[model samples]
Target chain A: MYDALKNITFIIFDLDGVFYRENQSLEGTKEIIDYLNEENIEYCFFTNNSNYKIHRYKEKLLTCGIEVSEKNIFTTTKLIEHYLFENNLDNIYVLGSKQLQDTLYDKYTQNSINPNIVILGMENNITLKDISNTINLIDKDTQIIAANPDKLIPVKDGFELECGVLIDIIEEYTKKMVQVIGKPSPYGFDTILSKFDKQKSETLMIGDTFETDILGAKNANIYAGWINSGNKLPYNTLDFDFMSFKSLIELKEKIKEAKR
Target chain B: MYDALKNITFIIFDLDGVFYRENQSLEGTKEIIDYLNEENIEYCFFTNNSNYKIHRYKEKLLTCGIEVSEKNIFTTTKLIEHYLFENNLDNIYVLGSKQLQDTLYDKYTQNSINPNIVILGMENNITLKDISNTINLIDKDTQIIAANPDKLIPVKDGFELECGVLIDIIEEYTKKMVQVIGKPSPYGFDTILSKFDKQKSETLMIGDTFETDILGAKNANIYAGWINSGNKLPYNTLDFDFMSFKSLIELKEKIKEAKR
Candidate 1:
């Protein structure tokens, strides 16, 4: 059962709940990173959140006492840039955060009239009017893409509506399909694997979210380890065989035990 | 074939697109009204729009050269008031226009925390934050009701999203069924029929929209007449029998011919 962890040389970690929730670092953040560094095991952070840039995540990680290069982090914004470039998509309209808008608009032309692609990301202040305007801009030919398919993201107070809600509204109204760039889509997972020059079998994705982290690992054909960070597994697991740990400390102990 | 119009002593008219588009009166509005008046047939206006008060609708109809009492105009706001009163419900939360808020809040207690019902209506400036806040206020026991299920309303420029979109988002996110108060639900039609004290067989529903006007008539077990008004009939009609009129003048002529 634990033998699968022994062959895992490269690891992909989901940020938010796994490493740090909001600005506060969770348990075993520094310990697991230290253990991975000592073992020469490669690991990188992958977040479905497109709200902030890579520097913000890097700064946040530093606050958690885990120093990592910006190259080791992969946000959906980065994955979207790669996706657009690879697919030769331009003339964009983004219904997302300022950071996402600034990043994508800098690389591509902002066409509100008729864009080649319409990118949707999580925005705190998104309005129905904005969504309506986005729908108006979208014609039959315009491509729709989203950062992630997480309907609601757990916040300090309660669950806040995520990018997936926007996707639902847009897709239902426009009757168009929205391509998700983040987890469970294999685009982000494949992109991360290719960047690290690692094979799927050699990589293990550890995250709190089962739908994205575990299901995404399965989708990308990578080994999965679910870190129980106060999130319940959905009723139907679809019979996925993934290692589960109570905490990152437990995960670190399991990896050490496997190696020994 | 034309004998159906002969039995229609009481007529239910859908205001927008049928009688008028915005402030401009469409062709045959006054003609149909005059014909109904000459024949001593009872008629009233029923609109899914909850934005305006009854007075505003009366004024709009007056501008269109069709003067009917405010009592004869049934907006969703008025119908919702009736619904809440009839169902013995209070402590309402409304995500609608200013008029709707004023109307409902005037009658029912404005409860943000643990309300008995959450009412959804079309609001032009509704934001995602408003929707998110509305979702937060809703508990498992809270009853969700929408003013209408019209997905889009034809505007001067293009189609504006209606209450149906709000229902779509709320229902999808909350996994709650929203009870619709307006057309195609039979609540509005039933209320109107009862108020007018007329049987469904002796009534006719004339409107431009097939889904709301035509399907609503079918749902209410009344005669339906679809006035072209530039709206295409849906692909699948479920084999419903209904009359079609190019304009109100044509409808008026058919009734006259049926009488002759």
Candidate 2:
């Protein structure tokens, strides 16, 4: 595990589970950040969540006692913005959080009649009628894009429906493919790599979820680590090899030992 | 086509497209009902909708200038009541409209902690949090039941999500099968047959939708007729033979012609 850490010059961390879970910072969150800075390792935070603005994530990291430049944070919203800019796409209709809608609408025209793109994200109060209206807005030429393909995200009580459920409903109804912009898609990973000028072999992704984080790294052809924060692996993951840590403290210790 | 209608002693009519669209009665709605009464054929209105009570449907039919007893109405809500009575199941958790919840809870205990059965129905204002709360209440032993398996129902503007989407999300998440009690499953048809003491060969199902109305009749081993109320057959349905009419007037003419 220590040997695997030696060549990792660039580290991408999943914010929700790895560093903090729902406003509480996990153990060694600050220590790991300090260690990375002292060792001159390039690091950034990446999350599949598009419900909040980039500034909210920056504020969340500040609460964890770790502060970083806004440019080092990657949310699905940011990646989608990058995609739209790259493709020169406009005339958007977003079915998502107010934060996401406000952010995107500030940059692009909000077209409900016939949009060039339909962006789906997670929201708490989405109704069946709202979904119907969104579906009605799509024409044959309309493009569909989703924040992430995560069906559910763990909450304090139980799992909450995610953006993937919306994607499932829309895609199944329309018989059209939705381009996903978050983890496990390689779009966000490639964007990070290109922005930071990092090589795949030298980059490591640390996350708690295997589906989005670890499998995402594999899909992007990068080093992966699983932070076992009491979340059980959904299946037997013996087929593939990846570094596993019981907590962020163990990961920090491993990095220290690797330097020695 | 007239020959097939000669021996039909019982008729099951789908309400939404056959009788009315929204609140407006379709062409020949009153004529068909009057003709059925004149022929002394037993008939009833059956709808897959569980969002409304039987009295609401009774009133809606009355608006179409057809008066019928409440006993002749079969909504999914009534069928679900029959299902619970037949199985002697109680302690329910309902994820549906206020009308559905109130109706079921009036007869059965509403157990949110650990329900004996989770009943799913369609509602306009259901939120993601509501769905998550419902999913959390289900244990390994909890039985899941849905009012219908219709994915989308055509509305005035476009299609609205139905009970089938809820079943899709819940079944996919829990890896459990949901017992569907509405059209295309034969449960509702079986209940209607048992109530009317009618045989399959002597029964006829007339509706506008192909998937639920036509396919359901075929599943129940009854004669099927498509009303063709401006709703196109979704696929090439040439393999199986069923009677088709452009309007309810045509169906009334066919019945009169057959008797003559």
Which one wins on TM-score? 1
Model 1 lDDT per residue over A97-189, tens place: 999999999999999888989999988788766777888888899999999998886655556788888888888879999999999889999
DockQ values, each candidate: 0.57, 0.83
Relative to the true structure, candidate 1 reaches a TM of 0.96
Distance from true position, residue B175, model 1, in Å? 2.7
Clashing residue pairs in candidate 1 (N, C-alpha, C atoms within 3 angstroms): none
> How well does candidate 1 match the true structure, expressed as C-alpha RMSD?
1.6
Residue runs of model 1 more than 4 Å from their true location after superposition:
none
* Model 2 DockQ class: high
Task: Place model 1 in a CAPRI quality band.
Answer: medium
Write model 1 residue lDDT over B1-260, tens digit each, in one string. 46988888999999888888866789988888998899999999999888877898888988888888999999998999999999999999999999999988987899998899999998878877788788888878999999999887666555677889889888877899999999999999999988889998899999988899999999999999999988899999989999999999999999999988
Write model 2 residue lDDT over A109-171, tens digit each, in one string: 999999999999999899888888898888899999999999988887888989999999999
